[model samples]
Target: MSDPALVTIPARRGKAARVKQGQIVKVINTHGDQVVDTWAFNADDLNEFMSMEHTRPHIMKIMPAVGDAMLTNKRRPILTFIEDTSGGVHDTIISACDRYRYKFLGVEGYHDNCTDNLQAAMGELGLAAPETPCPLNLFMNIPVHADGSLSFEPPVSTAGSYVALRAEMDLVIAFSACPQDILPINGVGHLPTEAHFSVD
Candidate 1:
C-alpha cells in the first residue's frame, strides 16, 4: 500500500499528468491489464529530456535492478527505481505507442493512444511536442531471449503491483496509460491504471 499522503488518480486513456521535482511518483497497475509508457524532462529546460538512443546502451548493458538510478541524457540523476513490487519494469527497446504503430496494429482509426497523451501533457505545460522518441515501457513485459529476440508478453505485474520512482531532480514527468489494444502489453485490450504521487 502507498502512503496516505500520496495523491492517487485513475489515468484514463489519452490523458497525461505531470509530477514536480523531488516528488516520488508511483504507477500502479490497479487492474491486471494496462501499459504505461513514461517520459521525463527537466522542468526548467525542456531540451534535456529522456533520450532513447542514449539510454539504450545503459539499459542493455547495465540492466537496471531494483533501486538502480536512472540517469538523464545530461548525465544527471533523474529518478531512482526505488521499488518494483512486481519485478518487471521494462526498457526503451519496446516502441512507444504512436499513430504509425496503431496503423501497423490495424488500429489506425483509433483516436486514443500514448503519443496523444504525451502531446496533451506537453501542451498543457506549454511545451511544444517534438518528434516522437522511444519511451520507457513501464509494466510492459518485453523479454529478451537468449537468441537476442524480444517477445511482448502478458505483464508480470498483477493487480495492485507497482513501480516507484523517486525523482532526483525537478522532473516534468509525462506518461500515457497506453491504449494499445493490439498487443499482449494491454492484455489484448486497453485498460486504465492508477498513478500516485508523493512529495516528501
Candidate 2:
C-alpha cells in the first residue's frame, strides 16, 4: 500500500511531494477563498510535465469536472479528477505569479510569489525549477467577459472544500499556496493560510 501522507501547505508558500500511480492527492482549501497554483511532473521525465494548454484542448474544458483527466504536454494522462466539492471553478488559463510581475506593477522590493513557492517546493524534491508552466489554478476565480477579457474576482471556495485527483503516473506534484494580494486574490495582499494535502 502507498503510505498515507498529509502536508500542511502554509498560506503564501508552497509544497511538493511524490505519489504513486493510482494514488490520490487531495488539495484542500482549509480556508475558503484562496487559490492553490498547481503543477505536475512525470517522475521519470520533468520535460514531460503537466500543461494546462494541452489539458484545456484535450479535455475541451477550462473548468474540469469529476472524471476529467489532467494531461501532460506530451498528451498523456498524469492526473485525473476523481472528485470536487467547490462547484468546479478551477481556472486553466492563468499563469503562476512571479517576482517580475509585482515589480512590473510597481510593487517595490522582493516580494514572495507563486514562482518562489514553486521553487521552494521543487527544492524539496531536489529538482531544478524548470521553465514554469501555466498552472491549474484551483479555486481561483478569473471572470471572463463576453468580449473575451478576463478579470480577477474573489474565489468561490469555502473552508474545508477540496479537490481530489488520482495520479495516473508516478508523479512529482508542486503547489503554490498563492501569495497574490493584489486584486485581493486572497484578500488584501494574500494573507497566507494553511491547506491540507493528503494521500489515501
The candidate maximizing lDDT is: 2
Candidate 2 per-residue lDDT, tens place, 8-113, comes to: 7887888999889999999988878788999999988988889998998888868888999999999999999999997678899889898899888789998888
Query: Model 2 shows how many backbone clashes?
Result: 3
TM value for model 1: 0.83
| Candidate 1 root-mean-square deviation in Å | 2.9
All candidates' TM-scores? 0.83, 0.94
Q: Which stretches in model 1 have alpha-carbon errors above 4 Å?
A: 1-21, 59-63, 188-200
Q: Distance from true position, residue 112, model 1, in Å?
A: 1.7
Over 1-200, each residue of candidate 1 has an lDDT whose tens digit, in order, gives 55676554346443334556667777776675667777888777767776666754665542455666676677677777788876665666766677887787676465567777778767867776564557777778777799988887777777877788888778677777776656667665445555444445
How far residue 129's Cα lies from its native spot in candidate 2, in Å, is: 3.1
Please report how far candidate 1 places residue 182 from its true position, in Å: 1.0
Residue 183's lDDT in candidate 1 = 69
Q: Model 2 TM-score?
A: 0.94
Worst 10 residues of 1 by lDDT: 8-17
Off by over 4 Å in 2: 1-4, 188-190
lDDT, residue 100, candidate 2: 90
